[model samples]
Target: MKEELLKTFGAQFETPLIEEISTVGKLAEVPAGETIMDIGNYVRAIPLLLSGAIKVLREDDEGDELLLYYLEQGETCSVTMTCCMGQTKSEIRAITETEVLLVMVPVQKMEEWMAKYKGWRNYIFESYHNRLNELLLTVDNIAFKNMDQRLVEYLKKKSEVTKDNCIRNTHQQIAYDLHTSRVVVSRLLKRLEKLKKLELHRNHIQILEL
Candidate 1:
């Protein structure tokens, strides 16, 4: 676990801080498709992802959810941190995109660590900057990019996150993430297939090239 902390975070964390984290944090394993957090829910703890990925999403009153981004490779979900910090309920949803293992820190420790541990303070600020940049990029994609371009980018991101050239997801699932209809997704996918960019099969999409 210490090795994972160094590999994911860095060697800059003080040994005492690491020891404190090791003591206070509890290990949690979340199965794929499990909701880790939801909108309007008070969170008890924040997770430090050790392995696998979690998808962060925004939802509305109509039950529509849009994929905001993914938290992976030991990254903390800043939205959750914000909610915890402000003593407010979560404004977004988080779900395990894969079988994930994480270290859960008690909610109260967030501020304690910041005031007492330099490493924790740095980690929180870094997490904020990273998440904010990602959100900005997502907004740019939606506001400036076309659907076909966005679809291609989305497919590429999924493949990278899953670490597989062959992605196993249906058109409906893809549509749901992009907040579009299945028909629109299928049409764009067919167009990409015609251009030999990808090969489509039953519940599978094999990438031919970028």
Candidate 2:
């Protein structure tokens, strides 16, 4: 499985760092829709995706949730980094959006590698910057954008992220992600369809102009 690590990021880190990862990292294959991390729970490892994607979400105490972002191939979850750096539980949750293959570095090794290796330090910093921007964008959408515009942009992003113009999701699923009612989502989708922006079937949405 060490080869899998190299395959994901070949020669990007020094040989010593690579060897450390090889020795300490564990490979995991997660099925689509499975929760990898949970709210208020401690995260023990920082995962580096080798393939597929993970959806990151933030949930409140009352069980209300918001779609935060998605981590795809070659990306690490910054929330994991935060858990590693301090004594803290996960504030957000991560669920596999598709069958996922990832290498998990134990929290100890994650902290050690950050201090011991330059490449690992850079990687952690980059992950932090990227995820921070994603969270900010989510906030901007919620605070400023209208639900219809947000829904359209969300669909466009979903299509781009999955690399499929035909999105395989139900109206209820979309509503849940957008923090809106299913009836509202259905109405917006119908409006988009009528405007020639997209076509919707039972569970598939085909982008025509978006």
Candidate 3:
């Protein structure tokens, strides 16, 4: 299982060091749409994605589902720092069936590892920096981009069903991804369709560059 994680990364640094990370438990074939961690629940182990994709989503003020991001194989855990810092409530959910390798990593253990292993500590530091940069980018997008621009970019990335070589995604799903109302998405989509900018087939939207 540890070998699988190395696939996501470019190269294996040191086999002996990774092998020394005592395996906690193998969570195999986790069913789709299952909550790996719950809001207000305490998370102990550091989860590493061994296989499958996971969707990180949050609920908005009006009880709407908003997609934060998708986590794929090779990416480390998300929002674990909040859990580590004793934050009781988490705003994300796992939206896909995922196989994860859980390491029994406590805060003290992390400190000890940092103190002893410079290489491991550097890896951890880089990981945190990457995560912080990602969060900052999301915040910048939200603060600077207009709603339509954000929605358009989001749909372009998320449209999974490509029919006839055209990107297709549902309006409701796009609304969830945009953290806005479905009706707003529908209205905008229809307007775009009428303007010959895009085409709509039932719930599926075909993106047109024009």
Local accuracy of candidate 1 as per-residue lDDT tens digits, 48-152:
998898889888688787889998876898998888888899999998888898888899999888898788888889989999999998899999999999999
* Tens-digit per-residue lDDT, 1-210, candidate 2: 777778777756777787787888888999989998998888888899999888898876778777999998889998878886796999988988888999888888876777898888888888899999998999999999999999998998887777789988899888878888899999999999999999989869899986
| Regions of candidate 1 where Cα sits further than 4 Å from its true position | none
TM-score of 1: 0.95
lDDT, model 3, position 80: 66
Which lDDT tens digits does candidate 3 get at residues 1-210?
565545543253245445545343344556655777655567665555555666666676776776666655545554765566564566566555343333334544555556666656666676677767766766777899877777766665454311132644466667777777789988887777888878888645676764
Better lDDT candidate (1, 2): 1
How accurate locally, in lDDT, is each candidate?
0.87, 0.86, 0.60
Candidate 2: count the clashes: 0
Which residue runs does candidate 3 get wrong by more than 4 Å? 9-13, 25-27, 60-62, 85-91, 97-112, 159-169, 191-199, 206-210
Q: Better model by TM-score, 2 or 3? A: 2
